[model samples]
Every structure is written in C-alpha cells, then in structure tokens.
Target chain A: MSITSLPETDRSVPLNRNRRSALIALAGLLVAEVVLGSIWKILPQNSAVSPNVFTALMFLMVPPILFFIYDAIWGIKSRNSKMASYPMMLIALGVFVLGTLWTVMFSFTNIKIIPLFTPADWVKGFVGLANYKRLFNTSRWMDCPGLTKAFQSGWEFKCAGALPNMVTYAVLSIAISVSLGFLLAVMMDQKIRAEGVFRTIFLYPFALSFVVTGHVWAWIMSPEYGLQHSIRALGWESFSFDWIANRDMVMYAIVIAGIWQGTGFVMALMLAGLRGIDDEIWKAAKVDGIPAWRTYIQIVLPMMKPVLVTTFVIVSSGAVRIYDLVVATTDGGPGISSDVPTRYIYQNFSANLGQSLSASTVMLVAMAVVLIPWIRVEFGKKSQA
Target chain B: MANTSTISAEPSGAKPKPFITWERAVVYTVLIVCALFFLLPLYIMIITSLKSISEIQGGNIFVPSSNPSLAAWEKAWNSACTGLYCEGIKVGFWNSIKITVPSTIVSIAVASISGYSLANWPFKFSEGFFTILLLGSFIPYVVMLYPIVIITRYLGIFSTLPAVVLVHTIFGLPIQTLLFRNYFASLPQELFKAARVDGASYWQIFFRVFVPMSVPIFTVSVILQVTGIWNDFLFGVIYAGPTNYPMTVQLNNIVNSAQGGKAYNVDMAATILTGLVPLTIYFISGKYFVRGIAAGAVKG
Candidate 1:
C-alpha cells in the first residue's frame, strides 16, 4: 500500500475506533447531565450534591457540548475528518458554564444555606422582573419624602435617584473623553519634533491605575487646599470652582478626573492606528500633491476604521464599568451625582441583598447592550475575512 | 527611495528656504502649551507633597513657596492617622509589594502558557476555547466580584492576602492572555515548526525557543501587569484583610473617611507614594513601551 493512502483494514480500524470513542464520550456526557439534573431535583435543596460532583458534571457537560457544536460547524465547511482536541477546550467551556451557573444559583442563596449546600427557599421564589423593575422605577424610592423633595429641589433634599445619576455621568464622560482623545491623538501625530515625548506624556496616566491618579486629581481639584484656593492666593479676589461640592457639576468634576486617566487609553489606540499606516502611502500621497491635512482626513482615517471601532468599544466598556476611580475620588458623592453603574451595583450588593440582584440584572443588561453589537461585528468581520 | 530622491531634488531646486517657519514655530508653541497643560497635575502633586498642611490650606498652589517643607512627606510616610492607627501609608507598602509581586508573576505565567497554547499549538478546540476566554475578558471584573468573593469565602481564604492575589490574577488573565496570544501569533510560525521537526516536546519548545524570544513582550507584560496589580484598590479593600491593605486602600482611608477632616497635603503625599512603584517602572521601561507596541504585543 502507498504511504499516502492507508491500507483499507488500517483505515477502517482507526475510523471505527474513533467513532466508537466519540459516541461513548457523548453518551457519558448525557448520562452525567441527567444524573446531575435528577440529583438537583431530588437532593433536598442541595444537601446531597457534593461540590466536586458539581465541578465534575460541569467539566463533562461543557467540553462535549462545546466540541460537538464546534465539530458540527467544522464538518459543514471542511472535508478534513479529524476528532476535535478535547482537554483544554473542555476545561475552558466548563469554567464558563459552571461559573455562570454558580453565579446565577449563588445569587439566590443566602450565607447559611451556601455553606451547607442546602437550597434556600428564596431559590424557588420567582421575583421575575421585580428586581429589574425596582432598579429603574423612580417611584419605589420616590415614595420617601426626603428623596422626592431632594430630586425636585436643590441639594437641600437628599432624594437620591439611583439610575439617573449614573446614566448621566456615563453619557457625559464617554462623549467628552472619546472626542478629546481623538483630537489629542490627531494633534500629537503631526510631523513635529518631540512628538514622541508628547505621546509618552499623554499615555503615562494610563499606566497608573485610576485609584492613584484619582487621588492626585482630587487633591488638585479640592477647593480648600488645592488649585481653587491656590488661584485665590494669586491676587484674585474671587476664584471659586467648587464643582467637587456642587451637586450639579460634581459629575463633571468626576469626568474631568476620568478624562485625565482615560484619554490616554483612547490616544494610545488612535496612535497605534496612525503608526500602522504604510510609509509608502504617505509618499504616494505626496507625489500626488495631496496636502497632508486632506490626505489624513480622506485617506488615512478610512483605513483606521477598525482601530476607531476598537477604541470606541474599549472606551465605552470602560465607561460603563467605571467604579474604582469614582469610589476613590468622589465616593459617589457630592451627594451621589458621580454615581456610575458599577458603583451602583457595588453599593447595592454590599448594602442590601435584595437590591443587589436587581442592580446586577441592570448591569448585565447594560453590558449586553454594549457588548452584543461589538461582538457581532467582530465575529462578522472574522467570518468574512 | 524614489520619493526621498524627489523630495531632495525639489527642495534643492526650490529657493533655499529656512527649515523653521512661522507656522512651525506656532505648532511648537502650541505643542509646548499642551505639554504644560498635561504636566500641571504632576506639578501640583509634587509641590503639594512637599508643602505643609498649613501652606496647602493657606492656598499657594500656583507657586512653590520660598519655604517648601517635607513635613507632609514625613506625615505621609510615618505619622498620618488613618483610623485609630497613626501609622502612615508606609505600613501597607510591604503588603502591597508582596501582593503585587506574586499576583503579577502567577497571572503572567498562566496567561503566557494559555496564550501560547491557543496561538501556536492548534489543539482541536483551541479557537472555541480562546473565544470563551476572550469573552470572559469583556465581562466586567466587578460582576465577578460577588461570585469570586463567595467562592473564596467558601474556600476559607476570603479577606486574606492570598484572596486578593488570586482575585488580581483572575481579573488580569483576560488582557494578559490577549496581549501574549496576539504577540505569539505575530511571531514567525517557522520557529514552532522547526522545533516540532527537531522532536522537541511541547514544554521544551516553550521553554527554549519561545521563552527566549519573548523578552521584549515580557517587559511590556511586566509593565502592564505591575501597574495593574500594584494599583488595584477594590480587590485590596474587599479581599485583603485590614492588616494587609495596600497603599491605595490606605490612601483612600486618609482621603475618604466619613467624618474626619480631609488632609489635602497628607493625601497628596500618600497618593504620590502609592503611585511611585508603577511610575518608576514606566520611566525605567519607557524604551520598551514603544517598541513593544510597535511589535503589536499590546492591541490598545
């Protein structure tokens, strides 16, 4: 027999063995899932199921399901007939599935039952969209006279509208940061001496976590011991920029701090896109007598679409997840005007168990809205490519 | 080459004009102005750190006074009260270092191996596996906090040094994996192919061929990871038990106590001290940063 063409018997034997193994693996996974499901139903609210049992079931179910889907898709496209690699793929899938299941299930259970592995009565208690309703519903908290008066009137009232403050902050911060970042990136990319140094200086803030940078900026922005007071000392009779205390502009103050930390991230992305441009393209443009400004606007920018999209996605995600910096600098105050989604979620989770699930659900929906389109576009491009 | 020649010829043929023009001068001036704008915060931070609380409160922020004292620095380092304890942020410096170092090492190691396997090894399900991992990166790290905390608590390690370190590593995995995988993918495939032909085992190829060639990217990883782990405050606060709080946590307490008066000078001094490690790393590794980005190691 030719080496390229295996003997009939040898091929048949290996093919049969492979088919048998895959079928066996599939059956084993089904059996494991069924056993786990039945156990979940019967086990006196989780008392019977071992932690290891859950982990093992997760491991088995995740890998085969993922591999089967992958193989099914692969089979449709290619003529190659090979079994999927299993181990790492399985673990990855298991971690995803089990982690998700654990999160969803654990959210319903309390501390006492969590350790004992007993299902809480709350587990079966279907709150439905009640959690989500409370999150977005203004009336729930508005019933409190203090909260109602606070929102209607000035900072005198302390009626804290949860969602409105965070949403406003995120929208303003994202708009300002992305626009300014793009502008700065373009300016720095001009053919000027010390451009590299400028880029470095702008990008340096990204290297420090918001916690560190926020503190520095907070001190500088402080009215009493910072720039505001300092400016007054310079023979200016009236210098008062106290946004840190002013509820109306407090969110903007937080945004200023955020921009200081975040603009560098956007600039770095834009710079990468700028640098990736071929030198020959610029030379060709010069030969064509195209002005540098026009060439950048018409030609270079179109080519940087992917980079711009990536920057937007990254920045938007960062905007939604704004937490540590806000907490560090504002602590969601000047009476909660600087509250953002992640901070809101964190506050709910830490303070009240009932509200935590609602906040998490809101967060999940927000992330989904942001991420789904980006992921779809990304996968779509990859598929087309 | 032709373009360069043409440029030289045109410049020579044209009347010899001065290299520096009014527009160029304006551009330079504007650029300098922007540079100063960026440097203002740093300028303020340094000056504030060197000044006393009296001067800081007295409001001379624009100019470094004729008498800039290191009293705040002393207070920040050893004597500023952050709760009942009068100890300064120096109390948490070693704990931060301990947490940061191990967390950085473990996260980078795991990410590199995972990235390498996904990039070069081409196991049957590598693509799908990697996709999941990539998706995991986009999940807000905060969302994972509750689940991770619960798991850690169940594991009997919550509110400890290890708890904080593990949390950092888990959170750091996504970006680190992305960085390394993209980097390794960009490397010449022939390197791996050659190793395979030479009967090199998986571990051998990774250790000998791949790891040696990874120095540039490793520096980038170190810079990014060190900055991330060093400056993490939430994980430090939530997971690191009180005795093991990081500098950021200490700084937060000093700046953000419920009823206590905010000490602006002490806070500034503490903030600078907390940022010192990563800032030093950036300055030292400045050369590697551009090269690493150019090498396509960091996507953003």
Candidate 2:
C-alpha cells in the first residue's frame, strides 16, 4: 500500500498496522491458487476447455491478481488505508485496461488469425502506418473514370472516401444545428403566449432516439410519398424534394434531419443560459435604446459563451459517433455517397480489422484534438481550486 | 433548478399582452410556423399509421383519412415480420425488457455506489481514475467496441443478452456516475458526518440514509438509463445477437429490410411503438429530462 495521504481527520487511524496480516493473507491466497491448480490438473481429463469454465476462471483470477499485485507493490509497504476506494479502483482499472487500453493496442497490430472466434489460433504482427495509408489513400476511388462526368458537371470531384464525407457531415451539421438552434433559442426567449406548448413541440424530438428521428424524417423526405408528393397533389406539379434519393443531395437531407433532432437540444441549453442572465441586463439594454436583435447578437450571446461551448461539445460529439441515423435514413445509399467515418469503421471491421482501427483512430484523434484543451482547462480549474 | 422559477414566471408575466398587437401577432405566427414544422412529421406518422394502404398510396399524404383504421398498429404490434419472425416487434419486446430492466438497475446501482464513493471517500488515486473514466465517456464507442467484443468473447458472453447488459453498464457508467456524483456532492455534508458519528457503516448509511434522500436523483438516473438502454441500437445490434435483439434493433430490421415489399403504415406504427417508451418518459418527466441534460452537459 502506498502512503495514503489522508486528510487531518483521518490521520489518527494508523493504517499500516495491518501490513503484516495482509502479507500473510497474500501468501495464503497464493497457496490456495496453487492447490486449485493442482486439483484442476488432476481432475480435468477433457481435451477441450469449456468456454464457461474459462470465463469462470477469468472472473476468479482477476480480483486475486489485482489484489496480489497491489499488495506486493503498494499495499504491504505503504502507510495509507484506501480500502474503501479499492472497489472503484478495481473497476476503473479493469475497464481502462480491458476496454480501452487493449483496443488502442490492437489499432497498430495486424492479426492474421482472429483469436476471439477461434481461440487456439495465434497470429499477430505489427504493421506501422500500412493501415493508415489504406484509410487516407482516396486515390483508389478518385482515379475512377466515372467521376470525370461528375467533374465536368461543376461538382468538385475529389476523393469519394468516408473521411471526406464524415468531415462534410460534421461541419455542415454542427454549423446548421448550432446557428439554427441559437435562432430558435432567441425566438423562444421572447415572452410569448403558448410558450410551453411551443417549447415542447420544438424540443420533443430531442427525446426520441436517432433511430426514430431518422425513420420519421426518411418518410417525410421520401420523394414519392412525402412532403413533395403531398405538395404536388395540391396543384404545384414541379415540386421536387427528392433529397433522400439524390446522391448529391442526400448529405444535405441528413443534415436537415440532424439539425431537426439536435437544434432542440441546443436551443434548450441556450434558453437555459438566456434565462440565467439577470433581468437588469435586459433593462439596461432597453434603457440604452439597443435593438432586441442587437442585444442578443452583441450582449447576450457573448455572455453565454460557456453555454455555447457546452452545446458545441455535445453536438459535435454526437456528430462524431453518428451511425444509427445514417443507417436508418440513407444507409450510405446511391453508392456510398453519404458514408461517415463511424459507418466506415463498422463496415471495415468485418472485412479488414486494420482498416477499421485506422478509421476509428482518425475519429479518436479528431475528437481529442477538439476536447483535450477544454479538458485541460476543466480539470486544471478543479485542481487549482 | 436555477431556471425553473424563471421559466414559470415568463408565461404569467406575458399573460396580459395586448390581444391584437402586430409584434405579438408576428411572434405567434413565427412560433406557430415553427411548431408546425416540428410537428408535421409526427402528424404524418400518426395519420398515415391510421390510414388504409390505399389511402396512403393514392390520397394526399398529409391529409387525415376519412376512415381511420387501427389495422396497421395491430399488425405492427402483433404480426409484423421481423426477419424470420412473423410476430412483429412484440417478438423482441420481452427480449428488450429482459435486457433493459437489469441493465438499468445494475448500471444505476453501480454508478450510484461509485458516485457516492468518489464524492464521500477521497483517496489517493480515486480522483485520477474518475477523471480518466469521465474522459473515457467522450471517446467514441467504436474505438472500444472491437476490444469489448474480444473480451466478452474470451469470457464467452458474446452474442448474448448478458453481454449487451454488460456493455450498457460499462458505457452508461460515465454519465450516470457524473450525475449521481454531482447530485451527492451538492448534498449537505453534515448529514454524512452525522451518519458517520452514529457508527453507520458505509453500505448502511448509503442504504438507510442517502438512498432515501436520493430518490429524486435516482428517478432522474432511472429515467436516463431506462430510455437509453431501451432505445439503444448499435450495442444491441452488435453484442446482442439475433435471438436477443432489442426493440430498436428489431424495428430497424423490420423497417429497413430491403427484401420484402415496404409496408409504410406498419413501418411507421412499429417505429412509433419502438419509440413510445422513451417518448413517454420525455413527455411525462419533461422538466427532469431537461434537468438531466443540463446536469450532464455542464458536468461533461
């Protein structure tokens, strides 16, 4: 046990008194493990290991191994009593090691034999930057002769890779959602009748899953039977809202639906921020003869920077991991025109493990680039206080 | 909590506005138009789900059908085909229940305990681990999904309902812990000191004292977890194999399947049915939902 630096109140309790006993307990545990191993070796005659037995053994081994290592390194020698934090630490360590650390390790490795499905197989080699080249090398598709027609039609023909699509999706969705959300928040801030109903109407979509929102919006965007069809039936025959089916316009259609679902959340956050502003600020602005729109744009929004940052983080995070909405809406239709990084990661996982890891690593790097500085300030403030 | 008073105060203060002012009329018009934009898809879904197939195919899609029928809803609930199962979403209804109920309970329980531990019991390495966990929450699940599959497969729980539940509890840990921790930290410290002075064990005090006081936060946590777990798709699709698929997964399969002829009405009904749980919670606990989001967003 490392020296537990307890607060003044806890200093009276001498935590190191049990070090000798804990050492003895550790030895006893080792003996028990040895005995159990002997028993297993003597009793097991089956040639194949049962998966259930293997899992049970893993569950049994983790705690003892954790405790044993901790005792040997810190618990037996340290003067701190942190037994209460042990469970939390154990779970955190398990999750970090097994869930995160392993995945990160797998990102750079090439597995010739997938071990999880076939346990006895073991083939692993480290391949540096090979997978990344495959991910970022959009020239494979860009060299296609078919895109020449696309280039001639005034469309900027570039790599039709998942990376470009994801970037476009993220940038467009975030810009539209945040700006539109701010507009709605400004509108809702007006002291008007049926505010509750209107607020509910606008924000209710936030509660529904992306699956549901994507489904409903897909139907509404259907050119044959949706808003366009309905509008055409009324007398306007040239109505064309075929964004869902159009390869060029499908990404925008996705953005519209995304904005629809996310704007409400952003608006709610901004509304809360707006409400938090003092009434005196509004009165002061009014007394100075400032226009309402000017007040919002110049005064209120700047004051709501914290709220804006929070909303940006939330919305951008959603954009980063967006998969279900795309699957439910476009499914990357019209020949992968609307593919996002997450969808690309998922698809590649089944076919090429290295490619999937490379794509997901790109996502992680993108998120970290945005999040790390904010996290530093957040935690830095906490540590300072 | 801070803005509740302000929010309620707005409508009453504006109740005496002039009935026919131009500005008021414009505000109302803008709000009504925005409301219509928001509500149009829902209206279409409800109406189309109630209309006959012929009406949906031939008539104006937005107009209400003269003869409303529950046949689509019935078909969605009782007999919609989900892959090989002819029994519709109800086939996965119980599976979802089995996955959601335990995942919610266990995730909330673990996170509450973790929150309580982190807030009340300070340790050398605890804060660092908490920070890592919080940051881990922001890391996209795709980064961890494959390794989690490998781990679960090694443990032999992959492609099972238990695997899905485990995944939820792991993924749900960060936000849930953040919620409970913040809520518990805001609580009066004297209650904890008093309980400690009374010789209450950690579990005892938690169960007998803090748990009771935590009912409201617990409600919020439950609401968050239940809706999240129930509405989950990616985890369910990946971890919970065909036999254990949740409602959302099954709904997607039913609606998005390219093999069969599309039944728009039944698809809408199934979509609505799958969404009903979360939507109900959203409507019923509207304020708490807002509170949950605010708390999560701020802390996150």
Fnat of candidates, each listed = 0.34, 0.47
- What TM-score would each prediction reach against the true structure? 0.80, 0.87
Highest DockQ scorer = 2
* i-RMS, each model, one decimal: 9.7, 5.7
* Best-matching candidate per lDDT: 2
Q: Mark the regions of model 2 whose C-alpha exceeds 4 Å error after superposition.
A: A1-91, A96-98, A112-124, A138-159, A287-289, A380-385, B5-7, B10-21, B258-260
Please provide, for model 2 over B1-300, each residue's C-alpha lDDT reduced to its tens digit, 9 standing for 90 to 100: 355445656444433656688866777787788788889878988998998878877888889989999999999989888777788889777888999999999889888888887667655666687777777777888988887777777766788878898899888988888888777776787787788778765678788989999988998898889888887889998999999989888888888763555788988998899888888998998877877777776533
**lDDT for residue B251 in candidate 1, whole number 0-100:** 80
Candidate 1's chain A scores what TM-score?
0.67
Locate the minimum summed-lDDT window of 10 residues in model 1 chain A.
Answer: A1-10
How does the DockQ of candidate 2 come out?
Answer: 0.46
For every model in order, the TM-score on chain A comes to 0.67, 0.75
